[model samples]
Target: LKDALIGMDLVIIPAGVPHKHGLTKDDLFNINVGIVKTLCEAIAKCCPKAIVNVLSNPVNSTVLITAEVFKRVGTYDPKRLLGVTMLDVVRANMFVAEVLGVDLRYVDVPIIGGHVGITILPLLSQIKPPCSFTLKRSEYPSSTILTS
Candidate 1:
């Protein structure tokens, strides 16, 4: 794998057990952490300067773990390490847009923080065409109502 990744410009690490196994992203802490650690080690050895974008389960925790591994190996670079949560952002955008009755394509929501159900922080405050959220008749509440 080192030879295959050699000279790579960007490495996206989304390696881990998927949801079909009844595992939440956070449930991956034990195995995925080590998986990421090993991969990042290889990346450091083969392409130390390459930008590493982590898209694995438990992204929040995995990202932090990646940083730590890189740091330990003296190859840590914040700018080169990224946690890709675009799927989370897209989910929030589509969900929010559905509530707003807007076209999903035009909707943009910035989902930040952890990727788990409770920890996922979808910031509507930064949404474009700034919109507000109204409560659904359902018991589950939108975290916050953002209006523009």
Candidate 2:
């Protein structure tokens, strides 16, 4: 692992137990956290300067675990550790495009916050091409009602 990582500029950590039927994100934490800890240990030893993009499930927690591991090894760089939330953005783009009857390529929606269920927030007001959608109060809760 050390030999292969030498001089690498980017290391994307997507290793985790596969999400399947009956398995919640929380269910994955135990397995994925161990995997992330082991991999991060190798990364710290081999390429401490590499940019680490973690795509592991339960990312909100795994990211912190990675940071703790790095800090313990004296290689923590907050700026270099990133928790990828691109999946949420992609889903928002697809859903918005479907609703607006536009090509997916033309749709752009910025999804902020963590990558989990309610934590994934689509910035509807900032959507490209300027569109609006009506939602029932019961169906779509107000942003103020949702918590991280």
State the C-alpha lDDT per candidate.
0.77, 0.81
TM-scores vs. true structure, each candidate: 0.81, 0.85
For model 1, residues 50-145, the per-residue Cα lDDT tens digits are 999999867778899889988988999999999987777777776677677789889888866677656777676788669764455222345333
Residue 44's C-alpha lDDT in candidate 2? 93
RMSD of 2: 4.0
Clashing pairs in 1: none
How good is model 1 by TM-score? 0.81
- Per-residue lDDT tens digits of candidate 2, residues 1-148? 7787788779999999977888765677888999999999999999999999999877888899999999999999999999986766777776777667799998888877876667677888988969887874214433322232
